[model samples]
Target: MPTDPRLTRLDENRVRVNNPHGIGATLFANKEVPVESGAVTELIEMLALQNTARQFAKAAPGSFDHDPEILRVAVTPDFHKARGIPVGTVLATRGYMVPQAIGNDINCGMRLHTTTLRPDDVTARIDDLETAFRHIFFEGGRDIPMTRGQRHAMFTGGLEKMLSETRRVGEGLWPLVRELGVADQLDRVERRGSLPAGRVFGLSDFMGEEGRLSRDGQIGSIGGGNHFVEIQRVEKVLDGTVAHAWGLKSGTVTVMVHTGSVGIGHLCGGHYRDVVRKLHPQQLKHPDNGIFILPEGDRHRAHAESFWDALHNAANFAYANRMFLAVMAAAGMRQVFGDHVGYDLVYDAPHNFMWKEQIDGEEAILHRKGATPARGFDAMAGTPFAYHGEPVLVPGSMGASSFVMVGQGNNESMASASHGAGRMLSRGESMRGFDDEFRKFMEQFRVVTPTDLRRADVRQRPDILNKKLEQIKQEAPFAYKGIGPVVNTLTEAGIARPVVELVPLMTIKG
Candidate 1:
């Protein structure tokens, strides 16, 4: 079999793939680690997927058939085929925004917290902490201090609006916020723990729609599928200067929460996606009918505003979701240990989302699916941690050590970094028994999961129990690419610099 001529190795850290159909879709991949043949095929498929976006290009920006709406597509080192398109793929476009590139889970991301507690403090009560986590994960991460109206405001605006609404209606989330001092933690959050808030983005299409203010119950929950809350130890500070700025030190305990907007995100993303599909249903023909582009929209009225508000609404909800979850996790730790075992949110960033950003003089929408923004100091000029650059948290697979890196703000990457070690295998293909190897692998750290209790304590059909166990095994460490190479690629590409190395001391998953 001859090699695909379109795929060319540009350099040790770059693989260039020219679009076969001459749509000018090019894929540049990181070659710091082994680039899998399967991933390359998936990347090619992603280019073909853009066929739908290309057609909708109102005025092409460069040389292309439809006036260049689809500008460039770059594959991150952690690239892998996902639900339909490839994850870790950065799709940049001018004049239009493709919804598929951001994914169904809006603002799905990780929130990292630097704790005052020492690793030894958590280790001393590891068993009790595990029990508390079992409750936290399975019990929907505890009750959030939010009301019906506040929940609606949170989705519409974000944590900032939610807090104000809470005050207007009652004493607000300040009780808990002041008690835990989590409100101040917003300084370290991306966008201050909220999306662009207020009526400045305008009202939603379903303005007076009844039951619109729902989802109060889901405010603090961690939606399933690769989502987790891990208590980790800062094993090493890779960059002393950056680490000092980010307040990271050796032996410090940190909690990382990864999740999305829960039901709200899904509803908003789906509703707007369907709206786009219905605009021209026949035009949605492609690998997944997944490529739909929204042009420079009026965030002030009608369908465009609906789409804009809905996307931001979901993003806002996701920000609050991760914030509420982090607070809940900190509370749980305080309960198991003591109030002195405190933690402060270090950084919160979303991977699965899209935003209109200006690259050079051209305005384009950067869609980051399973990728994090790696903006450098210039991009974060006014921020408190601007000196150290953006905190890009890369979570490793279950039982694997994760990383904390600072974005180098490389423009070639569209200021993005890999979300995690790209999945080497899909969930279905990686399913297997939780045999001796699986047990030993997880035993290294205290992992509290519902399956652990369900398998041993509860009685069920053998087939049913086995099925449950297999689902958990699909997320095993072996299912992912080695984190070492992925992080190395980030640094080598000049997209980011590794700062802190964190090893999981305890993990909780749905």
Candidate 2:
């Protein structure tokens, strides 16, 4: 086991760290340099693999090679090396794609919705806004009413489709939401924020079953884990060009939702793993890696196609999920702010997943895990925002500030950017470390509390709400790194430029 798991820079071109996974990988350094830190238990395995990867990078393509380009890739220090792979690992290949490279959480992503109200206006109404957000968010509840056509449109063409249809009525309760900038996000989203036409069958049977059983009649709903729906007000705008394109301005209120295909992605990943396991049982000798070797021919082809379709379905689900949340936010704002809080869909996108693209003139599948798509300025060639590029939402956990950035087209990065201030500690870590001070910090930001709702449930049963409110207080801003630094780093790296810094007034998490 690693005695010291900290990452340390050894030199300009090399770094050293005790392997996070104590049993895998062969650690190595250039002969001129030296290994500064490593775990004795697995240094042999780690060094050997590193040498093999380096050699593969220097050599031409060969049979059985898993994307030598992945070997040449570089990652930031915040990215921890994994058991069989590494977070931020990049792969460009024609031979075969590794499912684990993209990951189980398909289409996991972020969405940003803008509002006319500035930070001050939101601050003024924080208490009421928080009450409304709580009902719209964590309660797994909805207060807004939708007609049959709106429901159909939400599932079919999403918000834009609904908006176009609703414009004729002009009496739609949440017209102010149309201004929140959702239309602008359509072109920037993958597949124009629509589900791939041919991949519906790839969706998981489990997810289908669950969706059918869910009380909420929506396919694109936010699920558990780090996923959250936040009402934030833009505190600052760093890049005028990008900010204007994203419809963001200082003091503007925004709603950002982070979630993905949810259980569907998990279902897809689990299904593929079972198929792969059945094909090659030997790989199970080291199952922790989520690594599986696919056999040749039709079997491999089927697995790949099904996986691709599942991915597409999840991406679509995420797109719909964000749209649903945005719609809800619009309705809530209209009731509270009257016609003053106009909302617009600034940008919506998934930062995690795999897609086939031409990078540096090479046709390859780009797998982004905890990374956003940053295809430069010209990347969105066929979309409405093609000239402006895509808007990237980098959230900073539950209670921290979130960043709105525009893609920079860094070719070396396979046109990618970081997803957020990537987790410095696991969820369990936070649960264990949370103290009274942290609890107090979270309480300071919490604007809403269901006194009557909690009492009603509590009167019936002592723990009816299961201490959800109390547990939520642990996820304070202090638990996360400063968003300002993470944004500055991304901007410095030319991966993205910050458009807005949004401070959270109310947050909902599951």
Candidate 3:
């Protein structure tokens, strides 16, 4: 493929894309254009159009007066085309908040848990483990009962509220919270796994009775579209010092959870998108691109506050949701490995969210969609990760090698890194053809789902079986870019350095 004249190679791993519409963007990849050149093109186009709209909004004469500026834009190695904005894109802006930038799945993130059991220990009972995971994660085995007040607290205060009410909410996974000493593990979580929610919006139906504990379906669900719960074994340790500090050892087992707030996120994202669109100046023509900006100033103070409140509400739910999923996974593991197998949180962080940060000494909102925060030691100061820097969990596609990396804290990239290997092929493209390859790949790896294909009852239902098979094929490893190149890009660019590499033993897709 011919190189685009617009792209200028900044370094071995960084490419600078000059955007004519607004501020140019920095792309982090092994090559200039990256593997998904089409997605890169879309990213540039999206930035260009959004920037054009931003300029028009600023210049257009209207009662809606606010200053909005796009400070810096960075693209991670996993860049891929999405609805309005491309995945793996990060934008830093002043005086404006873009709801589409964060996307619908707010706080859709990664979680890593280091365990005492070894690979051999897990492989010995792989079948039994798969059965347990399917039951716990898919077959209604997860019994997370929460009261109206507990649910309200979770929406309002995140994991912090749950920690505070640990003594009172003693049912279902509540015991695991105390047994696993999750309170002590708060430091391991990003922002201590809590974001203050101004108010709970569009979640009254989910909250149960005040005194009784009730099961909420969304609490422990591993939502679709690349979300998974995997059991992995550490394949190698690159940075021994950091690996030791993070309790990662070769051949040891680990649990990786990838999900978010599910429906709750959609609710908040949709609500805010409409709110921002409605707030757009009545006199000026709305931008052709669906991207709408919410201004942050006295003119729209109430709306600005409402946007943050909604964002925080969804973010808080996501934090607690991931914790519950991790706990549920731990519960399943204990059924097979016994309670002796310890599960310690390595790190938990969001890839899709906005951060209130400083840009060149000015207050700015840093929006990261399908990107991970790679803050360095100084930035991570006062936390346990200060010495080693923030842990950047980059999971590869299904059945591929995942990596744990430490942030280099390069402010040029907005202190961010890629979230994963990224997609080389879209889901529709991946689902077609490659039938023989898909079968071979599945034969080599263990992927447990709600359906037991081996059972006669399931096998008899061809329609159901085919649908399940198609879902798995869409996320097959062939659909994604090579993990090796993506990880190398991070290290080469001084964005992040690998601490350890992990390979999956079993995967659970919902």
Best by lDDT: 3
Q: Write the per-residue lDDT of candidate 1 for residues 1-510, one digit (tens) a residue.
A: 125566776665666766575534333345445555666666666665456555544222321222335566767778877655678888777655667666569999999988888888888898788777666656544644444566567766677777777543323234556666655567777787676534422334323345433334566777777898898989998999999887888999999999997777777777767766665435334335355555553321256555667788888878887877787777778778777766666789999988778865677777889989999988888887678789999999988989999998888788899999878877876765436767787556566667555345444567765665576688888788889888887888788999999999887776
Across 172-259, the per-residue lDDT of candidate 3 in tens digits comes to: 8888888999988898899988888778887888787777788978988999989999999999999999999999988889999999
For 1-510, candidate 2 gives per-residue lDDT tens digits of 122345444433233443442312221222222122222222223323333333333332332334423322434322433444554444444434556555567777887777787677767876677666666655545533444444345434544565555554433334434455555556655666765424354433323332122233344356666677788887888888778766787777788878776665676666766765555433223333335433223435666666666666556656767776777776667667886666666667777777777755666566666677766668778766677666777888677778877787866556676676654544556666557766576456653433323356565764744465444544555444445555665676666777778888776565
TM accuracy, model 3: 0.96
Query: Using Cα atoms with residue i matched to residue i, what is each candidate's TM-score against the true structure?
Result: 0.88, 0.75, 0.96
What C-alpha lDDT, on a 0 to 100 scale, does residue 366 get in candidate 3?
94
| CA lDDT for candidate 2 | 0.57
Error of 2 at 169 (Å): 12
Select the stronger candidate by lDDT from 1 and 2. 1
Error of 3 at 405 (Å): 0.4
Q: Which stretches of candidate 1 lie over 4 Å from their true place?
A: 1-5, 21-38, 48-54, 57-68, 167-174, 197-215, 281-290, 297-301, 432-436, 451-456, 459-465
Higher-lDDT candidate of 2 and 3: 3
Ranking by TM-score: 3, 1, 2
In candidate 1, the residue pairs with backbone N, CA or C atoms under 3 Å apart (3 or more residues apart, or in different chains) clash, namely 60-67, 60-68
Error of 2 at 158 (Å): 8.1
